[model samples]
Target: MESAARNISFKEKANKALGIVPEDAIISKSYLFVSFIALLVGGVLGLLQGLNRAGLLELPLWFNYYQVLTAHGILLILVFTAFFTIGYFYAVLSHTLDGLLPKVRKMAWIGFGLKIFGFVLAVIPIIMNEASVMFTFYPPLAAHPVFYIGLVFIVVGVWMCAFGSFIQVANWRKRNKGEHVPILSYFATGVFVLLFFGSVPVAIEVFMIIPWALGWVETINVMLSRTLFWAFGHTLVNIWYLTAISAWYVVVPKVIGGRRFSDTLTRLVIIMLVVLNIPGGFHHQIVDPGITESVKFLHVFMSLAIGFPSLMTAYAMFSVFEKTAKKKGGKGVFAWFKKLPWGDVRFLAPMIAMIAFIPGGAGGIAQSTNQLNQVAHNTMWVVGHFHLTLGTTAVLTFFGISYWLVPFISKRVLTPAINKLGVIQTIFWTVGMIFMAGAMHWVGLLGSPRRTSYTTYSDHATALGWDPYLFFLAIGGTLLMIGIIIQVYAVIHLMFFAPKGETEFPIAEVEENATKTPYWTERWGVIIVIMLLVIAMGYVIPLVEMIVNAPPGSPPYSPW
Candidate 1:
């Protein structure tokens, strides 16, 4: 078998120097630009929210902060993360295959352009205060028809990227004949499949509810809409994290100079992710009024089931790290920890992310418990939990992957000084989130709400306790924003100003003794279908009940 790296030659260097960027580089740059812009927009919104909560910002009582919050959450969580995940998958494929897909490449660029244009159109009426409907697009509270129409275009654009990826993987398999798909590629393909089906609800909601809200349809059921929305929303975060995990699987082994502890186990873990991701969406509905107690309990149990794969991952990766560290002349259980390259940003960022996962997993377990769910639902505690998991753990993994890939993609060496700054930035982000989450959790125990724009003093003691917690959260938010800015600066510098170089890192190789498996089992289509069935079993019953007994004038559940 020929190595893919053999295809690249010195001649390609001249092409790159002539300002003709490589396909992977272009994709990476595009996603980076989008993510940077998203960070700015989301940050401004966050700052405003914090200020409003603290009574530092005053506006008309009629002004809807809910709309602003919804936009910020959707842009950061849905749009930006999706763009990054797609771009990262493309980068990995280009690197591993040592080639580009021309049709896919063109499609991706066009999709990105259209999505950006759609976002601009959607935001216009929002900024003008003419569209104050919250992000969920629940019926009866209408925005401009353009907002919903534009959202549909954005979703269509994302689908185009997903389809392009599916085609590229299919082509790769056909061309390679008997070669086994690399485990990382296999995992990425699985995630794309999940993204494909998981987004259907949001697409439908945008098409149906937006028009309905705009009076195109006579009436829509609000409850049914939220149910469907969560069906999609629940799995969306999992999809994003799955991509992050794929990056971690590829990069962690390289950073630690260790083969995966068990190749079979790693594959099993991925299987579990596909199986467990969507069923757990029910866990999100625990606090809803109409849902039955039995169904919520079933989801709570399934949520616990999702933890199995996480534990498996932790065991496999840590064992590999332990073995590698000992082989390199370190000794003892904890001593190997000391030998790790703490100064290397690539190593540190992921290490911190993994550490944050300890808290994330613990919080998840808390939320999954029926009794605990009652205590935490709709409280600042929920806010703290997600930020720890998604913001600290998942976002940091993205940053680490970008650090490793930027130089390879850009054909330039990022400044070591800037890279060091990035490491510090990640530290601040992790620490700040920890403090903020802790404070929020404490306050939530006293019944502080999650979605409120401000906290009012109904009693002196409650007000005093809430005020201090809000103050701490404000400080944490400021620190996180600063860290985010530094990261943006580092990414921009790597793209436009980093010194060009000819050095090539070898295509990462899996050790010969690494795990091997049958081709049929690895096919992503089979895995994804099984996953969908599991999700359906959990969701189908509730959906039926929602349809049969939905209250009049209430929105139908729309899980996107």
Candidate 2:
């Protein structure tokens, strides 16, 4: 089979007509523009929340924090992450599949238009202080009908992109029959499956519940809606993180200059993510009064089962890094770590991603245990754990991948000085998050709660213990904001002021003897994902039933 990377050279006649701009570069730049706008909106909301938490600003008495939180969560997690991932995948697939994007130019514009319209509709009620429900869509706390409708529109736009990518892959497969999909594309498709299946329940829940909440419907079952919403929400984060893992698989090896130590292990990790990721949402409800013990335990076990894939990924990637470093003349068990390019943005991105995963993984395990969850549920500990995983690791790595891929995708030359600045900003982000999240864990474990704007200690002794941690968190927040600003500036410079120059398209050289799977096996991967989703949701239904049928005074649904 002809490698896509090996076949990307343009004919001289086409080059003469089109100049240096590749079709993929055009698509990537358009998406980057959209992502930056979303980030700006999300950042403003995040800054406001941080200020409110620190007592630096007083909101109107009638203005609740829930709407702002919802906007921030959706803008950052859904809009920004989805746009970036779409762009990145498009860029990679165009290269790996060795095909020109026939319709991505039109698709990008369409996606941007739908997204902008949806975002505006969603934010209007939020800014007007009319809808204060948080992003979780938890039952009994609803927002304006437009908010749900707008969100559905935004998701629909994303689904279009997913469908477009699938078309691209399918077309590529048709043109190049008998060829195996690249590992990265295979994993990227797995992410798309996760997103597509997960979005189904979310769409159903929002369309059903939003109208009822707004009195457009006479009656609706809030409990049933909550069950469905989480069916989507829990898997949503997994979809985001799986992309991060895919990026890691592509990136870590390149930075270290070696192949993934175990291709089978990598495939298994992707399989496990598809299998174990969705059913584990029940662990989120361990403390809820309505859920049954058996159901919660089942979730706990499934959550723990996800660890196998995580461990496999860590082992395979780290082994490749070690081997690469050793080949570069490093010695000893840990001495090769020092040979790593700590200051390079490309290297530091994956390295810090792995570092953040360590704490995130540990915290996830601790939280999944029934006994341990009793102490940490609804506390800042949960906040800290996710910030490390999603905020620092996933977001930072996405930024890093953009920095590395954007120049190639744009077919332009970015200032090396700006690239260096971007790396510094990434470091600041990693360090600041470490400090902030560590402090949050400490304070939360010491009994400080989450989701409140103010904390009033029960006694002087408790206040004394908590105050310093809060202070450190404030400082860390400042650092993180500054780092974010630096990144934003760097991106702006790259997009507008970067010099245009002729450059070689990045060509990935594969070993001639590289192990390859059959085409049929790759197509069967989709069937496997369908099976996993069925099993995961099937397991959750029994839990949902128990919660719905619980007695009024039972501990499962008690308000206390």
Candidate 3:
């Protein structure tokens, strides 16, 4: 290994130190391609949805509204976000730790294969309208057995890759005693760790639902199943937020020419996130029956606790930007903001996403509040909130990441045209989200239901009054779809068509040296125990109630 390392070229040597190689890069790129493809499919579906919801278009017999909506939700959130995050984590693990072993490479391939197979299973059922249960799959409105099975495969397959990468990091820990793991890897580990535990309920949900869907069971308890599903659902989106924040922590400082605030502080925030995000899912089920008030209140408390880290992140992000701008001779409060690299698509795209999170995060807290949640639950306001956070914040960051990652992995120079296109895409997306999501928020407060076609809503006076806002939603969706197309084009041009060259992968920012991270933060035992206790406090009673007072299980009924 030593001899081989010495024989490599300068760039290869740098890559070696980072623990990545051309082959590993290829593995990461493949994951990214899946993300891009999903973005394309999901984005188009979103446009169709917007049009349908505005009463501007009718669904043909072949393609009904619900199927397209189901497909859109699954593709964008499940396929695009999950695949993209895994791929990005692979890169982070390789670069921040030791480059992956050949064994780990094989593990990745196996994981990839499983996911692809699962995706095929999932999509075929959705396309056939046998799985038009929507993304929630709220059983009683049962999909084909294949839909549940496909979901299990996806969950497990992604879990496999997450587990594999974590093992590699663990091995690295064994070899390097008394050293702090790199921040990016630590962040990646936190994400997957949350996923590992958060996914249990989903795995159980799928396992149970599949048998029921297949008619192997007489019925399934609907409320119990919803509790189980939501146990994983909101946490899943939190994983996306953590991943995006990790990206910002690792890359934004470099982009703005600053240093990471403090390693100890950052680790603490991540630890807080992992522990608090788990029980946070309960807030989503506040309106659902079979859960007690005290337990629901506990869930609300946990949700508020999770918000602290987001607040911490916000402080750190703006501080880094401020310091960077000041270093370039800025004065006065907020004056530094103008000096940021706004012209750089790589920086601008995510910065805007982060900016959107300020509002998105607030809405999250509001929705989690048992009092205010009465207003937001199951409304278009909920839709608007997620659009701001996951859609704009997370999805936009993913697009920004692709701007540099494509070139970095493809061994190509990103042409100026591609960069310009990316900036244009971001603009289109930001404007689109404002019009679309803003309208959703307004109409939701006025009592508009989410997830139904506009034509159906036309029977009511309030629904008829929503026409102007619906137009805004349709227009916004159109712009956002165009943005997705432009982004896909930019990546394709960079990867396969752009001239071969070199671009530096953005590594974490640190000032020369650090003393050390807190020992408690590094130890899994401390965080794990606290997490478990908090989770128990929020969950045990409510779940027990669900099992005991649960109504008779509902037999699966096929809508198709």
Lowest-sum lDDT 10-residue window in model 1: 502-511
Model number with the top lDDT: 3
Q: Could you tell me the TM-score of candidate 2?
A: 0.89
498-521, model 1: which lDDT tens digit per residue? Answer: 888642322234666665666666
Predictions in order: lDDT: 0.73, 0.70, 0.84
**TM per prediction:** 0.91, 0.89, 0.95
Q: Model 1 scores what on Cα lDDT?
A: 0.73
Residues 1-560 of candidate 2 have per-residue lDDT tens digits of 25554443443335434534466677777787678777877877776665565556655565545556777887887778878887777776766665445685466557667877887888887777655666775556666678778888777877777766677777777876777666777777777777776777778878876667667666555555666676677787787688887767766566556555555556667767876766666667777755667767767777787777888878766876787788888799899988777766766776788878988898888998888898998887887888788887788877777665676666555577876897888878878887788878888898777766654555568756776777667667777888878877877766666787543332223434656543444664566666566555555565457456744321111111
Candidate 2 error regions (>4 Å): 1-23, 60-64, 100-108, 457-464, 502-514, 518-520, 524-537, 543-560
- Highest TM-score scorer: 3
For candidate 3, the lDDT comes to 0.84
